[model samples]
Target: MTKKNVHTVPSKGGSGWDNKVGGEVVSHHHKKETAVEKGRSIARANEAEHVIHDKGGKIQQSNSYGNDPNPPKDQR
Candidate 1:
């Protein structure tokens, strides 16, 4: 089964951040930090990926909580 990834993106009004799952907004926050934290929790719980986007609508970073297809070589 495929798990839907969670994403933290800028809100439509440009006033805050939003936590989205499969293109649907699940939560909203005034701070990006809060949104990211919430998104991470959701992704971890669902064993999905947490994707963060910049204000310009570009992907900033992504964290995988599930079985990664391409894991890092260094298992630090």
Candidate 2:
């Protein structure tokens, strides 16, 4: 009777799924993907393909170092 001890019982009810496209039985429990999750997934997929944008969301100009930094080399 307890959920913890319940086994797969098809006669009354069971934790079974109907293998079908857009099945209500299966989709009911699953939550819809949020915008954040979708974005993260897209970012991950893009990273695998080495696609990324800088802070300006644009590729840095070729060989044009922006705001070049000089860390005072060997200045003791």
Top TM-score prediction, candidate number: 1
lDDT of each: 0.94, 0.23
User: Per-residue lDDT for 1-76 in model 2, tens only?
Assistant: 1111101111113332111112112111122223223323433433311122233334322121123244336858
For residue 75, model 1's alpha carbon misses the true position, in angstroms, by: 9.4
Could you list the CA RMSD of all candidates, in the order they appear?
A: 2.3, 20.6
- Total clashes for model 1: 0
lDDT of 1 by residue, 1-76 (tens): 2489998999999999999998899999999999999999999999999999999989999999999888989868
Clashing pairs in 1: none
Q: Per-prediction TM-score, please?
A: 0.91, 0.20
Off by over 4 Å in 2: 1-33, 48-76
